[model samples]
Target: MSTTRRLRPGVPVASAPPPGARPVQPGLDELGTPLQDVTFVVVDLETTGGRAGEDAITEIGAVKVRGGEVLGEFQTLVDPGGPVPPYIQVLTGITTSMLVGAPTIAEVLPSFLEFARDSVLVAHNAPFDVGFLRAAAARLERPWPGFQVVDTVRLARRVVPRDEAPNHKLGTLAALFGAQVTPNHRALSDARATVDVLHALLGRLAPWGITHLEDLASATDPVPGDVRRRRTLADGLPDAPGVYLFRGPGDEVLYVGVSTTSLRRRVRSYFTSAEKRGRMTEMVRIAERVDPVVCATPLEARVRELRLIAEHAPRYNRRSRAPERMPWVRLTDEPFPRLSVVRDVRAGTAHIGPFASRAVAQQAVDALHATFPVRQCTGRLPVVPAPGASACVLAEVGRCGAPCVGGQDAAAYRPVADAVRSAMSGDPQDVVRTHAARIRTLVVQERFEEAAGVRDRLTAYVRGAARAQRHATAARCRELVAARRTDDGGWELVLVRHGRLAGTAVVDRATDPRPAVASLRAGGEHVPAPVAPATAAHPEETDLLLAWLEQPGVRLVELDGEWSSPVRSAQAVRDAAAAVAVALVAPPAPLVDDTPPASAPERRHTA
Candidate 1:
């Protein structure tokens, strides 16, 4: 799709400065196309229902206008491929019979798009009409052109007074603006009315210095003067995927962000009301410059953003502020290993979690304890207990094997410790099965509160274990190379080392990927082997990589070590967790007796 920018008919062109003279800097007025020069396609649509994706468009009408002159008009009836509701038919006066011989949306979309091409889209409620058009394009597997949209409803709300118009509806705005064509719920008439409303709103805004197309956004949203002045900070940024940092007075990073699309557009958005976060507004106010770090692929940009956030710990960046704070459930090194929630991972310690919180880690520990006869006490147990050491209540209650008091020798408890280690490592079936059976027993006994607590603990343990195992599987691999086909038929190649996103590159379609793959492997960051059961990278970063790898059509190009999970164990736990969740939500079945009372008759009564 092509977009054309045309100047107003009578506007004069500026001449270049003489060879010796200094070049003049352009002002904000010269930043974008003037309103009079912009071609706008006033559009309207009649759909089967209010929803965009689910409902189908029945009619499309658009008027392409420039310099207050109607250049061309397009109108078509579309076969929605479904029955229209009676209310819709009545409101639109377009019944199913009227659409019997009409072309389908797939047939009508191309012509409509061509007609509206190179023009800003103007609509009464822009999202409603544009959303349907976008949905149609997506359904047909066509790319929707990036079009500037102007919602006349929003403009009217800002320009018109409540005393002059009761509401900003299309009909009300049309009458208020004295439009020649009145909207009657039909597509073409509504579109024609919207054109007049748009022109009238623009005229009202013209006196307020909204003569340029770029000014319309600010006019509708009313951005602060200070923030708007800083838009120039993005003037030199490139239109590419990258990480951007907002630096403050002392050149200290205040905020960090990443953009897969044009970095300039993304940074410019912070000056508009589109960025509504109070903290971000404050950050932008104090921000002096925007620094861009361009990357070859979006994945690389994202990874760089994460690293920058971690390094700077920017105040405005709430996420990735303290990845080190993620808690892990580790089996400590001892004669009788116990689950301990620690912030760091040590070599040779069996671990299962980088859970969201310490509380969640504790819950998982409780679940493990309920299943395995591991010691729950915080104190460390010896290889041999004191001569007269007594067993704790946990041992008396049979909850623990009390190796602390020598009730069970290390030789006898070795199997139990090994089982716990196995569960934390990969095989969690024993733990899952034990927890599932106990939860079922509790539910049957009508101990619902107790069952819910057990269910939570079970869910926490299973989810954390599954996540940790997946991360560990990836982190243990010495090196891996993967590729996925991009939307444009190009290839997105990634190199991973010890689960860290080491490098990424994009290979254009029809180009040989071997060179890029070779370069990525050669230049990728070096990541040493991580401690056992802990990922080399932050858990969050590893999680992102795993999700990307699991996307459909991702192909593993190379692997140095096996990347696998205990499928049966994880799946069994997931199934049991899902069943318990359903059982908890549903009301319990009442106990029914088949035998009737001796004094009661088994006769049916007539109403």
Candidate 2:
């Protein structure tokens, strides 16, 4: 049997503010109620089964505390109107006979609700106990007070290191925190044990500045003391859009990032609990100082951040560190042109990718070969076939034109070469039409797996070609100016030269933007002409610019060169490929199951 400490008569509990009256607001330093001033009702429940509505709660226990002082306790057994399952009987030591004369839930609900009024509820896996109580209230047609609940199990996972406690089970945490009372099967003993665990967790969180009630609610994985101390490093940073660099002791750049909001707040967050990434935490510890490069617009800041990450190849930054490593599919500059994946761009050659990987680029090549009779052999083929030269197995299977063995001379293969060149540069309808027909044929033959493979290859080719053509058109222009209206009714102007962001400026809504545009043009970076198939800036940087330019409400202020894709461009192919993909992955019809599902079995503990 667990003991109950009844509430003293005439003691008033706190209530909500009167209707329509404004509540008093706390100061910044007192943003939330201090943890010590909060009243907590630690609770546990013993139930006949795991479910709430379907089963019933057999016993209820709770302890009320404030400022570490025990104010009261509540414990009771209720008649569940049914027999307790034998497993639950063994688990909770509450037999069917023991609940025979106990008060029904209808009789016990009012007293328990009054005991827990105006307090934050605490529990190990709170949903299990609180859910049962709410279900009971629903059954009685009583309006259950919406109490703020906290789960100590969730709090322990954040506060206690896994090394100190192997798991966050109630029994495990109770023992780890040295609780005064050991939890048995009974309700009150577990509630008493949970109170001690809750206090110990609060103590551990104090050093991390989680001293307030709202802080406890929002607290995440603990930020180290050293990391917290370094928050001061962000003090002098300006509150504006910009790029930031974290520098190590040797002044080597460790990481580069951009912020569209306040640089100071963003940098400070790196040292706070919100930055939960392990690699970022390690980077912060190694970082010695932060350097800010404030920009006039968020786009400029993003572009500059990409450039810096590419230049420094920062060890701590995972993305855009090696933009130069991206592979492109180039039509080799030879008498017999063939697709080749190359890293560096040359002055003159048709190219079709900045593919995500070599494997994807190769797939695109396969799609082209399946459609065109371009040679698949790697070695350079002579203008004329040698006397004893032999054609490989590809020629035997009609997959290649076999120009190496005079099956088709360069003159005869000119139309095939021209078709492949057209597909790579201007018109891709031939490849798209060929692939669609083959896919349909495969599907008719019920070769779904083969059809899917062809679909993926076609998708890779079309998407990569479309992206490449879009990039090339923009990169070919000498200078382009564009503008978009900002949220504050100002204009954000940008000067781009050969796909590189040369300059950016923000103009006030009241002021004329012509002078600012002229000034930006005069002061912009001097970018030289880019070699064919290569953008003046990194492909990633150009990609960012293209995306920005394509956004709604953007106006083209000026242009120096024609920027256009072909009439039957790869964009159309891309759309067709998307349709094929949808048809390929469509789910099959669902099967009907006529038999009823069995009820879930009761468990020993909700935890």
Candidate 3:
């Protein structure tokens, strides 16, 4: 496709510098240009060697552009006096026999340099190629051109990333982009790919307010592409605990996550980390940049995350509508009183067992007895153990009826396990439905709060019903066992294929609220919840947290089938992430303040 029409009106592109003129800094003139109009040239070179300082150039090709419009093109082949190395000749299909009487760098250098005048230099592996040109300039006693250069390799990693591929070699990129590498290894062929890659890169950078040539040319080393540009912003982040934002280009918000230590490192890892493979690649694609807001402590990061989430309402953030009204689990203080789902697990009268993974906590009631059994372990049966007249382990101690051991009927233990499951799931509706028939027995003789708790639990279930609507409807929600977190958590879902999602389930639930939500909502197979608080300093915990947090950089999150099982859950995440990435690719909508008119100040929270 012609990129000129898609130039975003006047967006700057990485174009080759004019020939026979010294390279100059790009973008400065764009700033000086009318409303940021400037020329750009996507440049490419093919040579007989590797080292820019020592290699001999075989071909040079470039595309000159102004304000997103192609003005002209330049290409030429130079002869190297010495015979080309065997490997070099094989790789590039160039031969000393073909270059019998070609012009030397001394002759072609002037035209190429002059043509590049007042424009930016661009190459697939820009540094390697630009390095050679710079060295050549120095060898000729001319100062190396001060022209700005754009690295399409860097741009490809940011614009269109893939975890399977390490460095974005021209061939690797061409295969994925499907852009024909007709004249592979030839400067003109590679130059065409450079131009195409530049166009894709420009589209990716549009969201970052990176339009003018000078803006792209003057960028620091690596010419921060879409996702990698986050590195620069990450530098300002402190290692201490803090919240971070993954911003799309043009200052659009992508994702909001928090960390306890090494905020900058964590953020940097998301862009460069390797473990982030399998989902999250889409964010890397749209993420032309990132901007971080640091905090001195983790507590601060939590508060900050909540506040930012409230403000940004990042499409990728958790989808709870009313966090303050979300349900919580309530376990009575009595030795083994029934556990109830409530609105405040932290507020009052509730011994808040830390929120755990959906699977761990759901199946945890039994696991807990396995760890510490007691007179407090049973629901209907009394806590005393009986003699060996066929008693189970818990029954051996009078704790359980030992249905599995044949002490009691399966029917007898069913209700008990069901209650445990209900409690773990925080399903107040189940509690009410199961025990409502007993209401008449405790009728006027009861503590109202206990009964009221049941009513409130039912209400929470009802309220959450509407919220149970699926986000990834296209994700096979019917067969999917999704996590129903109350509130406060984030998930990393990778979308690998153009229309499909792939990869592992990276559920990061911490002592923090958002993570708590993520833990509950991630329901595929069973990944055991963290044993202690996520604050525990274990290497596995740290590594897992880091893997989920930044995704080890964008390229790594391709949602590939590297991690298997939990297919439904993985699809759920990938579907959600793809939905968000799609939104990011388009323009962002204006933020409308949801607050009510000042005359009705109290209604602000009603939404």
Q: Which numbered prediction scores highest in TM-score against the true structure?
A: 2
Q: Give the number of colliding residue pairs in candidate 2.
A: 0
The window of 10 residues in a row where model 3 has the poorest summed lDDT is 469-478
Error of 3 at 167 (Å): 5.8
TM-score of 2: 0.60
- Candidate 1 lDDT at 408 equals 83
Off by over 4 Å in 2: 1-220, 434-453, 573-577, 581-607
> What's model 1's lDDT at 539?
75
lDDT of each: 0.80, 0.81, 0.48
Q: Clash pairs of candidate 2?
A: none
* Native RMSD of candidate 2 (Å): 18.3
Tens-digit lDDT track for model 1 on 239-298?
999999999999999999999888999999999878745567779889989999998887
**lDDT, model 3:** 0.48
TM-score ranking, high to low? 2, 1, 3
Q: What tens-digit string does per-residue lDDT give for candidate 3 at 127-179?
A: 88888788777887877668877787766655554555554777776665555
Residue 150 lDDT (model 3)? 77
For every candidate structure, what is the RMSD over all alpha carbons to the true structure, in angstroms?
18.5, 18.3, 25.8
